[model samples]
Target: MTDATLDRIAGALAGMVLGDALGVPGELWPREKVRSRFGRIEEFLDGPADNIVACYFKAGHYTDDSAQAFVVLEALLKAGTVPPAKTLADDLLEWVRSMNGFEINLLGPSSKASLLAWSKGEDAEAVTKLSLTNGAAMRIAPVGCLVEANEHEKLAETVARVSRVTHSTDVAISGAAMVAQAVASAVAGRSWDEIRTDIAAIHPIALVKGEPTWAASVLARLEAFEAMVEKLGDAPSEEDVSLLIYRAIGTGTMTSESVAAALAVALWCRDPWLAAVMCANMGGDTDTMGAMACAICGAKCGISGMDESVVKYLETTNGIDFRALAKRILEARANFTIGD
Candidate 1:
């Protein structure tokens, strides 16, 4: 990989960590509670808070989002690309089965469901029918990076293969595909407008078409997503911008509303720091949103786009050196040919 490519990967990885850490503190707070408690979320504050991170004195510790992302990264490294559905399912199940000690912290709800089914001797294809959670989208960002510059078909297939092992709902698969495609576009240096437009075109069938249930809500909220994207155009104040989007959109549910809210934070930020902080503070499902936002901004700006404070905090708290992880992934990529 070229130095620039490595730098971009590093930035994105760091952005993921930064976002995970930032969002950890406000994971389940309602919008009003978040606003009342934090008074407009900006920067990592040390104190009691509803989010998991506040339980620790340090900053930057990651939750299931970043940890599962690393699992996806590991799978990509070993498989040499996005594996096919059966292969992906087997690999993920094997990984989960091998978990011992500290590795237990990484599995999520959808993954847990799949693992339990597998343990009970269920078929992989049949097991996936049990879940409809955000677990698929949460870990699939690495697929975006792994298949950089690929078209929507390739991206969608990769996401679907990985997702169907656990998250088979159209909403989960579509959300994963959208995130992967968006990250891939960003990595290819596409403009944000282009990324959004491309995502809209890629998933026309999956966009909301009916009442606002979890499955249909992401599509139903398109107008609100577009509005937030528009508001982010002027480079508004980070605090004001985050609140505006949070109030206008919201960060609840596993649907598109949450994804759009996270994307709004990334789109509005002048840098990865602001993106991570803003997404983290939106409360419910904060870590997942933060991680997704980090992936988007990090792909666009590279590691230099992040704040030193954020990087330091993540390393100290999470015991994960995101920059090193990026370098390792780049090295792995260099050793394999495109079709290998």
Candidate 2:
């Protein structure tokens, strides 16, 4: 990969964490509730006391989203190809144990249950039946960083394997596939429109994997977002679109809602910083959607194109060395191949 691609990769790494940290303060609140507390939420603030999960984290600390994404990165590197579900689960279990995740309440419901089941020697595949949350979609961006967009079938299969570790429902894997491929497309220098189109093409392929769920289709939700945008008219302000999505497309933990909302917001905001801020203020599972949306924006803008102050704050506060992580991913990117 070229230096530009590396910069985009690094930007995506930083962007996901930045979104998580930035949005942590307002997470799980209603739109009105977040507005009542933080107003616009432009800067990183301490997570609100009312937020059970976010309250434990200080300002600029990423939650389980970025943490799990790192696990996927580790799993991929160790596997030297598509990460098997067992490898992914072991890595996840180790990370959770290391972080005291179970005691701390950092994990979402699906992840908490899935990991706990696996830890108790439950059948891993069988345990994933009810995991229809956004846990998989929240962390799958790393797969996009390593895999190419053109490898759609391989990407779908890889995502199914990674997601089946914690989230094996049809909607869950489909959302994860969209996120992974969207990031891959952005890294490959595809335009926003092209990336959106690619997501549509990859959705059904991913939908075929995993257990069936009664949840809404992720592709249909994206179309809802598209219709909402058309009704929004031209050049609407960030708040207008954010509110529209909050009321219509939703910003919750379900894979279809959160993942599609992230994609929608990122495509509309187009600016990495603004996309993250929109999600932060939009409320309801802010950190997750923010991470997803901002990763896409970061993939497009690269590190240099992001807001310098925000990037600096993210780097300084978070212990991660994003540039180093990006380089490591690049080193492994060319050698690891996802199989059909």
Candidate 3:
């Protein structure tokens, strides 16, 4: 891979970690409470009395979003390609069972369900089919980056395989596939809109209205973001800016809404640090949204594009080494080519 490509990958990875960390502080707050307490949501608020943020602050780590994403990254780093369904399933089960130290910081419902099924002696594949949650989509960004675009079938199959190990609903699989395809398309220099459209075409049954319903919602919020950026300029108070964007875009159950909110922050904030901060402050499902935003913005800006503070936090706190991971992913991709 070229230095430029490697740099972009590093940026994306860093962005993901930054988003995860920033969002950890505000995982599940009601929209009104988030707005009232934080008064504009910037730079990880304290908590919503009792929410994921409080747990995260006490533990100093994230939930299943970051853990599972790391697992996906580790799997690719070890195998140099997407592992088979059984392999992925086994690893997931093992990870859940043997989780120790800081690893137990985050455990989502879908993962919990899978672990329960495994403990009960159900086949991993069968257990996964029973899930309809967003677990699969939450950790799929890495898959999109590793596979080649031409290998669409392989991509879909791999997504289905990995998702079925824990998430069985078609929505879960489709959401995961959408995220994977989005990351792949971004790495290949395609427009986000184009990528969304293509994924919709590929999985008409999985997506609502054959397009991500949230993209439009996100697009609508972009105008508001632009307005805020204009009014506040570069040094806008983080709290005020966060609330402005959050209220306009929303923080809710819809995956598109959450994803779009994060993307809007990235689009409005020229600085990667600001983008990550804004995303985390949005409160509801903050980590996932922040992670998604970071991935998209990181792809656009590169590692050099992020602020030193954001980079330092990710490196020291999260223990993420983007450059190394990027090299490993590239090498794995090359090996995949050779094997083919």
- Candidates' lDDT values, in order? 0.66, 0.87, 0.62
RMSD of each: 4.5, 1.3, 5.5
Count of residue pairs whose backbone atoms collide, per candidate: 3, 0, 3
Cα-based TM-score, every candidate: 0.80, 0.97, 0.75
Per-residue lDDT of 1-340 in model 2, one digit per residue for the tens? 5888889898898889988888998888888989998778988888777788798888898889998998888888877786667777888999999988889878999898888888888886666888878999999888998888899988998898888888889999999999888899998989988998999999999998878889999889889888877886888777788888988898999987899899998888887888888999998999999999999889888888887777877888887777788888888888887765
Q: Lowest-scoring 10 consecutive residues by lDDT in candidate 2?
A: 79-88
Better of 1 and 3 by TM-score: 1
lDDT of 2 at 24: 91
lDDT, candidate 3, 177-262, per-residue tens: 65566566656666656655545443533333122222333333445566666787767676676677567666553444564465
Tens-place lDDT digits, model 1, residues 173-232 = 777777777777776777888877766755654323211234554444555766665666
Error of 3 at 266 (Å): 5.7
Residue 304 in candidate 2, Cα distance off native in Å: 1.4
Off by over 4 Å in 2: none
Query: What's model 2's overall lDDT?
Result: 0.87
Give the C-alpha miss distance for residue 84 in model 1, angstroms.
6.4
Clashing residue pairs in candidate 2 are none
